[model samples]
Target: MTTSRSTYHHGELRQAVLAAALDVIAADGPGALSLRDLARRAGVSHAAPAHHFKDRTGLLTAIAAQGYDLLAAGLAGAPGLRERGVRYVRFAVEHPAHFQVMFQPDLLRADDPDLLAAKERASAELRTGVAGLTDVPDARTAGIAAWSLAHGFATLLLTRNVGGAIGDDDPEEYFRSLTGLLFSPQLDPHGGE
Candidate 1:
C-alpha cells in the first residue's frame, strides 16, 4: 500500500520542487532548470512541478518573490545605508540562485501578485536605508545609487569579473571600502566642495 509519507501533499510537493529547483540553480544556473529534472530530484511525478508552477517563468517568479523577501529581511535590521549595502551583497553571495533570478525580469511573471508585494517590500527597505541622507538632493536617486552600487559589486564578484585585480582583499571588505568612499561626507548640492 502506498502510504501518505511516500506521497507528498500539494503544499509539500510544491516546497520540495522549489527546493530542488533552487539546488539545480545553485549548482548550475537558472537557464539549466528543467521541470522533469526537478521532479526527478524531488521524487515526484514529472507533472508535479508543472502543476504547481505552470511553467519555467512561473517557477522563476516564485523564486524571485522569495528572493525579495529574503533580501528585505536581511536589510531590515541594518542600521544605515552602508550596512544595508553590505547585507545586500551578503544576501547575493549566500543566495546566488535567488539573486540571479530576482533581477531577470524577462524570466519571471512580473505581474504576479506575490512577486509585486515582495519587490515592494524590498524596495521599501532599501529606501529606508537612504531615507536620512539629506546630503542627496533626491532620496529616490540616492536609493537607486546605493542599490546599483551593491548590485554591481555583487554581480562582479559572483562572475569573478574583477580578474584578480583586487587580489588578497575579501570582496566584502573591498565593497565596504568603496561604499565608504562614495558615501563619505557628501558635497553640497549648491556646488560647494
Candidate 2:
C-alpha cells in the first residue's frame, strides 16, 4: 500500500494513521485493530502508528475523544430536547466507528485527560438539552432517558435490527414521533401513569 517512499516523513502521518484505523474498525470491528495493521494501511512502517498512539487503547482513546467532540458539536444549538436527541442519533449513524469506540469505556484509556474532557463536554451538551424540560424535577434522570432513547435507536438502526419495521419512514421522523410519547405526562414516572 506504499504510495510514496516518504509518506511517513510528512507531518500528516498521525491523521493518516487515525484514518486508516477507522477504516479497519469499520471493516473488521475495533477488536481487530492493531497498530501494525494501521501502519501498513497508512503505507508506513509498523512503528509509525505506535509512535503516534503508543498502544491500541491509546488509539481508541483518541478516537473516543474525537467522537465526543463531534457529538458536542452536533448537539450544540439544537432548538429543543428532541432535536438534540435527533442530532445524537444522526452523529452515531454517520460516524459508526467513532461512536462504537466512544461508548465502550473498557476499550479505551478511560483515564486519559483528553478523553475525560471530551466526555464531560458531550455530557454538558446533553444536560443542556435535558434542562429544557422545565417540568422534569430531575434533569439528570431526564438526560439519561434521552441518551438511552437516542443511543438505543441509533444502535438498532445501525445494526439493521429495525429492518422494515420503519418501512420508508425516515429514522429521524420515527424518533421525533417517539420523543413525543417519551415526554408525555402519561409516561412520566412521577405522574402516577
Candidate 3:
C-alpha cells in the first residue's frame, strides 16, 4: 500500500490535492487512487488530503471539475470551429489524466456547478459555430454533427485506434482539409438532403 508524504491544511489544499489526484489517475487507473497516495504526492501526511477530499470519490469529482474547466478554456479564443476541434483533441491528448476522469461518470460529479458551467460554455461555442456554418438550420443538429465528427476522431486517437503518432502534414491534415467540404457553410450546393 502507498503512503502520504504531506498534510495540506484547509484553504487551497482542496485544489492542490485534486491536482495531485489527477497525476495519480494519469499514471495509473482510478483504482490506484487513494487519499494517502495523494498526500504522498503532495508531500503531506496520510490524512491531510482526506480533510479536503473526504474520500477518493470526492477527489475524482474535483479532478473532473478541473478537467471541464480546462476543456472550456481550450475551446475559448479559438480562431474558428476547426481550430476549436483541434484544440479539444489536443486537450484530451495532453491531459489524459484529466480526460480520463472527466468521461468516467461513475467516478465524479460531472453535474456540479463548475462542471455544468464549463460544459455549457464548450457546447454553446460549438453550437454557435455550427449554426453559423451549416444550412442544417437547427442548431442542435448541426452542433451534433460537428461535435460527432471531431469527437469520433478524438476518441479514436484516445484509444490509440489510429495507431502511431500523426506525422507532420499527416493523415490528420487530410481530415482537417475535409472540414471545409464536409462541414461547409453553403446550403446544399450538392442539393438538399
| TM-score of every candidate relative to the true structure | 0.88, 0.91, 0.77
As for candidate 3, its clashing pairs are: 4-40, 5-40, 5-43, 5-44, 6-43, 6-44, 6-45, 7-44, 7-45
Each candidate: RMSD: 5.0, 4.3, 5.0
- What are the lDDT figures for the candidates, one per model? 0.83, 0.82, 0.68
Which ranges in model 1 have alpha carbons more than 4 Å from their true place? 1-10, 185-193
Best by lDDT: 1
**Collision pairs in model 1:** none
Candidate 3 stretches greater than 4 Å from native: 1-12, 165-175, 178-181, 185-193
lDDT of 2 by residue, 45-152 (tens): 788787878999999999999999999999888867788878888998799999888989799887899999999999899887776677767878878888899999
Q: Better model by lDDT, 1 or 3?
A: 1
Question: Model 1 over residues 159-180: C-alpha lDDT tens digits?
Answer: 8787397798877778778876
Candidate 3: RMSD to truth = 5.0
User: How are the candidates ranked when ordered by lDDT, highest leading?
Assistant: 1, 2, 3
Residue-by-residue lDDT tens digits, candidate 3, 1-193: 2423334444766777776677777778688898976776677677878776678877887777777778888877665567666677778778788888777888876567766776677666665455445445676776677678777777777677775655454434544664667876352233221
How many residue pairs clash in all the candidates, one count each? 0, 0, 9
